[model samples]
Target: MTPIRHNASGGSDNDTVLDAVRDCVLAVGVRRTTLTDVARRAAVSRMTLYRRWPDVRSLVGDLMTREWIAVATGAIPAREPGTTARDMLTEGLITAVRAFRAHPLFRKILDVDPELLLPYVLDRRGASQEALLELLSGSLREGHADGSVREGHPERQARSVLLIVQSFTLSLRTMTDEDDPDLASEAFLRELRGILERTLTP
Candidate 1:
């Protein structure tokens, strides 16, 4: 979930664009999609789409990028120190998953648009990576200070934890199990937290 762009006060236009793009993505996925489709869905002129977005790849890219930042920072509320690093990580990740699962864009996104988003995650160029890195690094440092995460390189530890979460969630998306996607997502987060806890401790 990336932070949706907004002005000083949130308005309707951007969300409008996102909603249109999401519906279009759901209808046609990302790889096979076109700007005209988004424009048509948005009920905006092609010139308007061009003015807002440079091209199809860029438009989709922007959505993926912002959505990621929003996901990384928006839902999982930071707070005072928790009892355990593992607990904090689990709760935070699960909160994020739930939010993503419920998000209109994400619900549509996870269904047909994994590949378009994966590269961006790997690229890690957008605000989402920065926000995620900051959040994880801050949390990890706090854990180290509290003797939850063992004394080590905070950046390395945080990077590993981030990778674990990303890998787990992406892996789960491809599963065809009859189980609920939300439950699968929650389980992925739980396992990620466990892995981080063990690594941080020993």
Candidate 2:
């Protein structure tokens, strides 16, 4: 799939517009947010928004891509002198799951227009997911070289890891029980750590 492109120039106007889109979505949802509302919120002309994004869905797509990539980038574990790639990957995935769950835009989307995620979840990969897969595959390759991860095709392993992470990120709420601390989200996150460790261990 062709990745959704943000403004190639990285202009402030793009940021302004996307920020407006975020606010609109958070307030109403993707379905209810209109290009007019976004334009008004952004203080940009309707023609300006139309020139870039054809519709609210396209605008929101770019918004989500931007938000999700930012979250994942921030969640990447920094390399330390003694940190193996496997260790970094495991930590990064766990951290990303936590960050994604806590992200305001993410929570808003899940709470409101969850159907917007159906295509990415059930049919095709989105730009953010593809970006994450690239990061995961690179780290998996490094882990293999360092003898810390099991031998496997990096792309395949990355996909598997992403699948696991997606389930935890999206479906974990259903399995959690706030009433019972044992079944809380953090408990599942601990299980996720064990699962990732065993999956990558040499």
Models 1 onward score TM values of 0.71, 0.93
Displacement of the residue 165 alpha carbon in candidate 2, Å: 0.1
- By summed lDDT, the worst window of 10 consecutive residues in model 1 runs over 1-10
Give every collision pair in model 1.
1-67, 1-71, 2-66, 2-67, 2-68, 2-70, 3-70
What is each predicted model's overall lDDT from 0 to 1?
0.65, 0.87
Number of clashes in model 1? 7
lDDT of 1: 0.65
Q: Which stretches of candidate 1 lie over 4 Å from their true place?
A: 1-12, 77-86, 98-111, 121-127, 173-189
* Tens digit per residue, CA lDDT, model 1, 1-202: 1233423112476556666776777677777678788878878888977876787767766666566667656656555564575457556765675666666666666676666666646764454555677677877777777777678787887777777766665556676364686676667666766776677674
RMSD of 1: 4.5
